[model samples]
Target: MSSKREEELLECPICWDSFNIVENVPYILWCGHTLCKTCILSLRWAEVKLPTLPVQLPLFVSCPWCQLLSFRLVWKGNLRFPRKNFFLLWLVESANGNRVRYCPSSSCDHNFVLPSNRSTVSRNGSSSSSEYLHETPRSSPRDRQRTNHSLLGGWRILTLLMNLTAKFPVVIIFMLIVLYVIPASAAILVLYLLITFLFALPSILVLYFSYPILDWLVREIIA
Candidate 1:
């Protein structure tokens, strides 16, 4: 929808009431809260430590209305202005000098100013400032996929390394022992070795990969 029509059709999920949205600015989440592209981009810029990958972006975001964590809303089409597209799309700073995410609805003109120290806004009916909530839960589909891919990739790499190390001594001994065997039986010995190596390779690779991951899990539990 065009920015003008989008503004008209958009309703606050929390309130279920129509609200005006500003075009060519921040994108509103499903929960009716507005967030600047910079805000979402900034989250992608930060690194979070994980067990598998040494570090990764903490892409999880919070809902503006219900104060729940949510996946980011991607802005596309004419709503995304061209001049500002490079900066916003790549997490570049806005020329206007405001680094924080602002309310995209030019009509509503609500700005999401995240204060230092607090991570989320409260939806509770309490009027007290103390009642305002922060620290929304962490949940992002991209983050989940990234974590899973990292784990699988790391295991594969580690297994490759382990197999190279573990089989070296055995391979050397097998070669040395074969050299001392009678020449008539040498062909039979070579065939036996080849069959043994082929049969054991898959199992060895599996054990190599599984052990370290298992060890890491155990250590995490103990810690």
Candidate 2:
């Protein structure tokens, strides 16, 4: 049997629902009180006034337990809420028999992995069931998987570029030649040809006309 303190830790004060990995993910406020994501969304949604126009305006979310007000902005018809409490989430997962493992590499897309086996006591001496309300969850596995794959692909591309730049000094020079040097050289050559043609044309016309005018004047003077 779980103690009263353990039960309190596992459940949200507002909805009285046990924190889970899905819908009731734990979120901590600036005032140090923890609430489930559903309750937080509910509070924010309650304060939303009917939009006079299509644009949804910002609203203040007040904590039910402390009445502490938090200013939140409406982004694309969704309220931007506080960050999830990962420590509390780990505790919840741990209490529910889910073992959390972190990636060894710092550059990993997913920070931690949760695998469920059997119920166990967490470091904080809390044990709970995995059942949770099917309220609107903040995140889904498919979303997370998609995000991880996108991030991993981006990282792979970045890593490949970095490796190419580092391993072969010629690659950097080749890129510079392709992206900057070649274009600049072509522009400079074109400008040089244009300037030479402009200057030479004016000088040749001036000389051609001057010779005839000078000879005519001299012939007139001689005659």
Candidate 3:
């Protein structure tokens, strides 16, 4: 990609500002639109510490922009955007010598630089991200694949179910009217919808509405 296009990509669609990895890092929503981390964090006021997932990746934070409803993981005990655009992170870090600032007043056109962070540096001075959630470093292909699977395994089936059932309240009632109440002669239509809904609805609802509730139960049994 050209530098201009990359700069455009690094710009957050929500705030229309250049991304600062520290605050305005790009967070991809479930809908796949990337927004500034600051924007996503400001949308939710509820603060809770989620338990770490064993053999699990990040926890799901509700996508405020998705409006339709989707989840992603909460990286911090406080409000930290979990899904990161590391490529963007590298781009910003390599910005040579730029400072991060917050525009305190809405009227302020100039940025007021925030106090420099006391970034954790080892005794030997290697920067470590043990505190805040940061992107993983490069790894072997097998390790990468495993990590990828861990991240997507929980979401893939869940996403499919959500998409399938999203129009259900209208579709289900329509199906009931046609499948049972309509003329019995419409056998073909009834057979198809019946079989499809019957086999799919149970799993769909379980994944969409009830998966979180059951997650603990399954974990307990596994333990």
Best by TM-score: 2
What lDDT would candidate 1 get against the real structure?
0.46
lDDT, candidate 3, 46-90, per-residue tens: 334467633322344445554533354454454444467555565
Clash number for candidate 2:
0
TM-score of each: 0.22, 0.35, 0.32
Off by over 4 Å in 1: 1-130, 175-223
| TM-score of structure candidate 2 | 0.35
Q: Give candidates' CA RMSD values in order.
A: 30.3, 19.7, 27.5
User: Using lDDT as the measure, which candidate wins?
Assistant: 2
Pick by TM-score: 1 or 2, better one: 2
Which ten residues in a row are the worst by lDDT in model 1? 90-99
The segments of candidate 3 whose C-alpha lies over 4 angstroms from its true place after superposition are: 44-68, 72-77, 95-223
User: In terms of TM-score, how similar is model 1 to the real structure?
Assistant: 0.22
